[model samples]
Target: MQGENVSLHCRKKDANSSYTAKFYKNGISIGSSSSGNIMAPTVSKSDEGLYKCSIADAGESPESWLSVADLGFPQVLPNRQQFFQGEPITISCEGLNGRTGWRVMKKINGDIRICASTWETLIGSCNICNAYPSTDSGEYWCEHGEIQKSNSVNITVSGHPTVPYFKFYLVLYTGLSLLLVVILLILAGLFQHHKHQQTIRSHTKEMSLTPDDDTLYSKAIYTTLRPGETELKGHKKRAD
Candidate 1:
């Protein structure tokens, strides 16, 4: 991996002999060591190249190739599947091996864009102060000089409120409306039943306070005729 320790040693026929050795990296002199060994601590991608060592009386050794790879993939901070409009976001492209110069890349609506070229960014991170759904939602990853790439992540930005909770609110509103309608229907039914009961009570009270048709006729006849007139009226009727 990238962050590893490397030690180079010069070999000789006499192992007990003390000789000064000089190290060269990519055809250039690096340093000289009296112990015939050189230690490179915490090697990175920049340290990868050809290396060799030369002795005072002996010729130069064969050149060896050193390769370095990334320790880990790039990551998005506060990882999530969704974001809101105008929300701030950060994407980190720094390698775990402490390597910088990694650029953040994104593919939105089939268009590819780089953070260093298209957006504002720092050394190995992309920061968006105000993210928009139309332009910010897509796949994001890291790239180094267009040669190496990291794992990608899918991001979705919502223009409205959180989708799941918004749906829940809609459902809640509908349920409350239905409940209110049911309550109103029950109240209307109760009012109608109460009015019918009151009408029935009023009819019963009138019947109890007033006399019947036959009783009213007898009272009217007695009030119109006298007692003697009643007897004469009966005798005249019999003679006729």
Candidate 2:
């Protein structure tokens, strides 16, 4: 809410024992404090911009966007019906009455949420950080003392979809693994076949040695019988 005190913290970058921080808005120095927090006593439209903080010995922190909502009739800023997942949203309820007792109400996923009075400010606004598709997308409105004070705004939050290339990689991995297994099986079969061929060749060599031994015995018997026959023929010739 405008005129409400807001605090911006400067997170420390280094492991310094003590921190003296300077706050900046869009490259302009707002204030310097020892507590490392910049306090805006009364925030206005001019207070909104990219904000950061820097320490003496340390460097500057990353910039953050600061949005200030104008206190108009009770409503949601940028009254859009659709919002993406993880988007920031602001709900303001500054009606004809100026910041007396206003609360932000949201109905999401069949549950209703009522923001506390302490959560509201003179600006009658509060920030919803990182809206979720499942939890934060719903109808939101503002109320004051049991009376509906603002227009109901329905917000739709859509999450990022699954990437196509991710599934492609999954299929690719499956195919490669199957192909590798098949190739290994083929190599194993070829090795077994080679071992079987070697065993058959060894068995054939043993059979060939048996044939050679038979042939040598036949030749020896033939030579011995032929000499005996020659002796018998000589004896018959002598008897005659």
Q: TM-scores, in order shown?
A: 0.40, 0.32
| Candidate 2 TM-score, C-alpha based | 0.32
- Model 2 local distance difference test score: 0.70
Residue-level lDDT of model 1, residues 72-151, one tens digit each, is 65576667768888888888887634667888888999999885555445457888777888888998887665655666
Off by over 4 Å in 1: 1-79, 84-130, 138-152, 158-177, 212-227, 231-240
| Worst ten in a row by lDDT for model 1 | 231-240
* Cα deviation of 17, candidate 1, in Å: 6.1
Model 1 — TM-score against the truth? 0.40
User: How close to the true structure is residue 232 of candidate 2, measured as C-alpha lDDT?
Assistant: 39
